[model samples]
Target: MRSLFQTYVHGSISAVLGPFRRYLPAVVLLGLLATALEGIGIGLVIPLLDVVVSGGSDAQGFLPGLLVSFGETVPRETRGLLIGGAILALLSVKNIVVYANGLLQAWIYGQAGHRLRTALARKLTAMDASDLLSEPPSRMLNIISNESWRSADAVAAVMGIMVNATAALILLAFLMAMSWQLTLVVLLGIAAIQFAHERMSQHFAGLSKIITDQNRGLAGRMLHLVAAWRLIRLFGREDFEEDRFAQASDSVRLAALDLQKRQMAVAPITEIAHATLFMAVIFFAWSLGITFGTAAAFIILLYRLQPQVRQIQAGLAALRGWTGSLDEVQWLMTAAPAEPVTSGHLPAPALTRGLAFEQVSFHYAGAAADRPALHDATFEVPAGTSLAIIGRSGSGKSTMAHLLCRLLEPTSGQILVDGTPLSEIDRVDWLAHMAVASQELELFDGSVTDNIRYGAPEADETRVLEAARQADADEFIRSLPQGYDTGVGDRGLSLSAGQRQRIALARALVREPRLLIMDEATNAMDLLSERAALRILEHRRGKGTTLVISHHLSSITRCDRFIRLDRGRIVESGTTMDFNEEQLARMLRTTGT
Candidate 1:
């Protein structure tokens, strides 16, 4: 429990002070000034009560001593009015300062939130591709959108704790000056209640961890349901999914209830402790022959003190609740020490010569050591030449593509681009010269033109139309109600599978890359449409390099060269013309296509 509190408090401070360190001193100063003003206002209550009791008699105690020294020539009536005016003035100044402090804190909070979110995003972008692939998308989404915001809320809670704690301390100082004996008794009683509350509240941190896990689980399940809605309905598993979701939600509900119960107990326990202390203090003062007016003033001060103490306790509880989120944000921001994708200082040159893989071998992390994904695979594609890699599933076709794209580094051998080591070229520049379209299509909720222009945003309208025509999507796009302006629903659900693929193809083509990669990009299209797509590739045959990863036999016949992979090894390599009808049939049969 002590560790939990320390973690939360440290995280909250690091998040707030680390991002907004420059303005923190100013914010602290404002808080102190506001707290001082509040203390002065509370202190004036005793003098007002004294004036009322003695019918505007001369001021008493330390205040009177100061006022008499400061205003000997001032009249008594004027002095009383001045004191009343000073109290009002002090309260009015405190209100203004409080409002200003709120504005500054808000500014700091907004700045810190923006900084943290931006830094998280940048860190994710800079992370290694392998690390990113190992993580679940739902977890990343939850941390970026949900946990990051909660971290910002934690900052606000910390600031509240500071403000309230300061106010309580200043008020306590005023109370002690008024009557030391009574103030000491009240302090002791409040301390005892706070200690008990802390003991009971220890469970909140664990409960919060449970709620965080449940929320992430629920979010993952919800995403699965939405993405696989058709399958769920086809299998008639609606009730099953509902039950799973309900179970997750119920866990969250129970955890929240337990935390709330512990938190809600603080108020009543503190109130009881305060009321009993007030009664005991009154009896003790009466026994000591304290005056009624003094007793009444002290009671008013104690009443004001209770709320500040409560605010302090509530702020502490809120901070504890946010500990889990802070931990998540910290995890998201920290990157593991792994091999990164881009680490070169030299700019990537144009692929004028060719790309070559020299005895390349790669094994995924945690994969069977003996069964590597790609083993001793060696190939070369000369510039302005096309190469088709045909293999059955689990034969390392996709792994080769990933290696070519620099998404995965080769474990044993080097990949050279134009005779330069691939790792020595800047990744961003290398990627800018290449484009890929895979079996998985990623289309945002936008218009046809927006999706096509995603890769080459500055492409002119003429270029976009040409790219669409090249992908055989222009006619279908024109048939829509708004043509290029028509909106595609989320994930392009409003479009057919072929339409989405064509749009993705168009996105790749619009970049006019030096190397174009198509990994089963036309599987959804019909035979005629697939033939038409291949015709477009035929036009770009000698103009630039192309890598076609497909099981379809017809898709590879036009390539300049072909390679057959089986069990992570290259089984054969030659031009399509070199293979006889029998050999081609056997290759197709071996690949099951």
Candidate 2:
């Protein structure tokens, strides 16, 4: 919904000319010169037509008169060869320029495609989390992978309409100069044919939008199928997924067929209409007793003019078919708006005193107005200490963590570090001091060392091994065939749930962050492993700040204090001895389940 549409729609010719703008004047000049050369080549043919029609009488036409007065008193005997040679020369130059223009246009559009892809990628990375999440991931992927390229070609189609229109106009002017009477009749008929096609163009554009939407949906289905491949087999529902994919694909094919049928209808109908007009001009010339030389020249010009008109009409229809692509590229390139969230320029202060969320409240974009995911959520984790947040599923625990991580900004209130609004701190500087290991692991498809060193790419092997040892993963990792260099496979699927979580924890530890966040980080581990992981967390007690978000009481046994959330509200806050183990267990039994 957010886009550069207003700016792009006003310009028909961008790969909707964003990066190609600087070369516009040169490109336009070359295009115009090529078109002019083509027109001149066309005019040179007029004299040849006159020679054939009159069997060597003095040619009498505006163009033939030019050669007659072509900067010389020409001998009549050599006029035909002279005009013939001129025609060849003009055509050769015109074709050469046309070829070069084709190369330039191709490069311009290629650059546009490259720019569009890179720009969309940059925008996707740069957008605020909420703005990025506003649209479906599959749809975004569809635009970036497929639609951007199509949009570039769509821009070329739009340019085709422009250049073809110009050619038609120039040829029209030449027709009028030859004989306005005949030109008038021809113009009206051509106008009527194109007028009828105007409605077809609108329909084509409508179908284009539908196909674009359908492709986005299909992309979602494909991505889901790939992502859920194991799940589908485990559930024994491969047939169901196949049928679902088939239906979506069939729908896309039918829509495209309908569009192609409508598009193919343009050519024959225009040709038939113009063919009738072509003959009508011929018969009318006989009736008017126009001079033979002039009529031949007129017919020749009209013949050349016909294809240009056809190109304009056809390009118009095809351009309409690509309207969706242009719109999508425009959206992807500028979808984040001017400034979705306010950010500040100040450097992040060291976490000396504490980090506090004061009366923080946030809801998703389309959630209920009255009910927020986290409301009036006030809490603090002092420096050199750990705090535990216990909450049931959907109790806004992860939302709180996301806010803390600056993934999402609060709808109101402020998260301050050392009493400075966290929003005012440089985000990159803040992130460098923080790391998170959560229930949802994000292990990349790479070696164990690679995943551990992901954010800290320059981290050496000693740091990676030490981090893995801290997370209790070094032993199992060394047992694998490639040890630290073993490929994790897609999302680390080759590893067990516990193994992946340990790797994720190692990733967090490898950074040695100032504030470490562990959100259900030990859930996948066994009894011994979970206790060991909890013991490992205990080591950060006084050297750094730590926040543990968990439903299990054992996971936060070493925390300095605790906060409990029922739904979005912080229902309780206290030190460790405030609640008995039995009472804490009873309270958290249903938290994550």
Candidate 1 clash pair list: none
**Model 2, range 175-280, lDDT digits (tens) per residue?**
7766677888898988888887775556776688888888888899999998789899999999999999999898889888988998998788889989999999
Q: For each candidate, what is the lDDT?
A: 0.78, 0.78
The global Cα lDDT (0 to 1) of model 1 is 0.78
204 in model 1: Cα distance from truth in Å?
2.1
Best by lDDT: 1
TM-score of each: 0.87, 0.90
Candidate 2: pairs in clash: 14-17
